[model samples]
Target: MVTEQHSFITSAKRVIDIEAKVISALASRLGQDFVDACTMLKNCKGKVVVSGMGKSGHVGNKIAATFASTGTPAFFMHPGEANHGDLGMLSKGDVMLAISNSGETAELVNLLPVVKRLNVPVIAMTNSKHSALGQHADVVLDISVEKEACSLGLAPTSSTTATLVMGDALAVALLDERGFTSDDFALSHPGGSLGRKLLLKVSDIMLTGDDLPLVKHDALVADALLEISHKGLGMTGIVDELGVLVGIFTDGDLRRILDARVDLHTALVQDVMTVGGKTTQPEQLAVEALNVMEAHKISALMVTDEARKPVGAFNMHMLLRAGVL
Candidate 1:
C-alpha cells in the first residue's frame, strides 16, 4: 500500500513539474506579439468574443470572465454554437480570441470565414502559426507545450495550462495598461468580500442617530454601561457638554474598573473612560477602520465628524455582520 501511495505521489509531482516548466518557458516567448494582443484588446471598442472547443472552451470561458471582471468587456461564444445561430453575437468593432491547442480545431476553423466577413480581427492561441486557425488570425499567440502532463500524451493538460496562462497574460496586461484600479474591480464584484472591503464605507455599516451608543461626560460609569448594553455595540462614547466626543468606555473598561473596585454609580464616565480613544470618520472605508481597530487591539470605534462630535459607533461584530471583517 505504501508503494502504491508513493507511485501516486511521484506521478502527481511529475505532472506538476512538467506544467510548471511549460509556464516558465512561456515567459521567454513574450515580445511584440504579446504587446500587439494587449493593444488589440485595449483598443477594442466592443466586447472581446472568446471561442474554443472542449477543454479549450472551458479555459476560454474562464479567460473571458477574467477579461470582463478586469475592465475589458468580454464573453465566451462556443464555436459549435457560433456555427449555428450564435455567430450574430460577434459584431463590428469586436475582437475574436480563438483558442485551440492544434490551431486546426474543425469547429473553430469553420467559423473563420464568417468572422473575416464581419471584419472581426482574430487572435489565435494555438501550438503552430502554420496551421489553419493561426494562418487566418491577425495575431498568433504560441500556447504550445513541450509535452503533455498526461502519461499517455493524449489528454489536454500542459497545453491547456499554457493557454490559460497566456489568456491571463493578455487580461492582466490590458488591465495594467488601462490602469484598472481595485475600486474598478470592486464595482464588478460587489457581492464578493473584496468588494465589501474596498467599497463599503464606515457610514454605511455604523450605528447612527438613536442607535449610536453615547453618554454625557458627566454621566456616571453605571449610566455608560447601561447605554453600552442598550446599544449592543460593546462600548459607548462619552461626549462633553458641547456634544463633542471626549472619551470612550467599553466592556474592557468595565472589567478593569471592577478589578480596581471603582464605584460605577459615583465615578464619572469621563474620569474612567479612555480619553480620546481611537476614532474613524464617516467617509473612511470600513476596511481602514478595521485596520485601526486591529492595530489598537480594540473591537469598537466611535465615528466622529471634523469637530469631534460623535456621529456614529460600531464594533467588530457589526463589521463581521456587514462582511467588512
Candidate 2:
C-alpha cells in the first residue's frame, strides 16, 4: 500500500511537471500569431464562434465563456452540429476560432468551406499548421506540446493545457484592448460572488429610514449607547441640529469612556464622539465600503450623501450577509 501511494504521488507530480513545461514553452512561441489573433477578434463586428471536438471542445466552451465575461462577444459551437444546420449561427462578420490538437478533426474541417464562403475569417489553434484546418485559417496559433503527460502518450493532457493557456492569453489581450473594467465583468457575472462584491452598492445593503442608528450631537453618551443597542450595529451616527452627519460614537468609544471614568450620563455625544469619522457614499460599491472599514480598523461606518448628510448606516455584518465579503 505504501509503495502504491508513493507511485500515485510520483505520477501526479510527473503530470504537473509535463503540463507546466508545455505551458512555459508556449510563452516563447507567442509573437505575431498571437498579436494577429487578438487583432482579428478586436476588429470583429460580430460574435466570436469557437468550435472544436472532444476535449478541445470542452476547452473551447471555457474559452468562449472567458471571452464573453471579459467584454468580447463569443460563444462555442459544436462542429458536428454545424454541418447539420448550426452553421447558420456563423455570419459574414463573425470570426471562427477552430481548435483541434491534431488540426484534423473532420467535423471542423468539413465546415471550413462554408465558413469561408460566408466571408468569415478563421483563426485555428492546432499543433500542425500544415494540417487542412490550418491551411484554411487566416491566423494559425501553434498549440503543439512536446509530449503528452499520459504514461501511454495517448491522452490530450499537455496539448490541452497549452491550448487553454493560449486561449486565455487571447481573451485577456482582447480584454485589455477593449479596456474591460471590473464593473463590466460584474455585469456579466451578476449571479456570482464576484458580481455581488463588485456590483452591490452601499445603499443597497444599508439600514435606512427608521433603521438608521442616529442620535443628536447634543444627546448624552448614554443615549448614543442606547441607540447603538437598539440598532444592533455596534455604533451610532451623531447628527447636528440641521441633520448633517457630524461624528460617530461606537462600542470602542464606550470602552474608552469607561476607562477614563467619564460620566456617560452627562457627557455630550459630540464631546466623546469621533469627529469626521470615515464615511462612504450610497453609490459606492460594497467592496469599497469594506475597504473603508478595514483601513480604519472599524467594524461599522456612517453612510453619507453628497451633502454630508447621514442617510444610512452599515456594518461589516451587513457586508457578510450580502455576500460582499
The C-alpha RMSD in Å for every predicted model, in order, reads 1.0, 1.4
Candidate 2 local distance difference test against the native: 0.94
User: How far out, in Å, is residue 239 in model 2?
Assistant: 1.9
Give the alpha-carbon lDDT of every model.
0.94, 0.94
TM-score of 2: 0.96
Model 2, span 1-325: residue lDDT tens:
9999999999999999999999989999999988999999999999999999999999999999999999999999999999899999998899999999898899999999899889999999999999999999999999999999999999889999998999999999998888899999999999999999989999899999999999999999989999999999999999898899989999998999899999989999999999989899999988988988888799998989888999999998989999988
Candidate 1's C-alpha runs over 4 A off are none
Would you list the clashing residue pairs of candidate 2?
none
Estimated TM-score for each candidate: 0.98, 0.96
Best candidate per lDDT, number? 1
Clash number for candidate 1 = 0
Candidate 1 per-residue lDDT, tens place, 269-307, comes to: 988999999999999999999999999999999999999
The reply for model 2, stretches above 4 Å from the true place, is: none
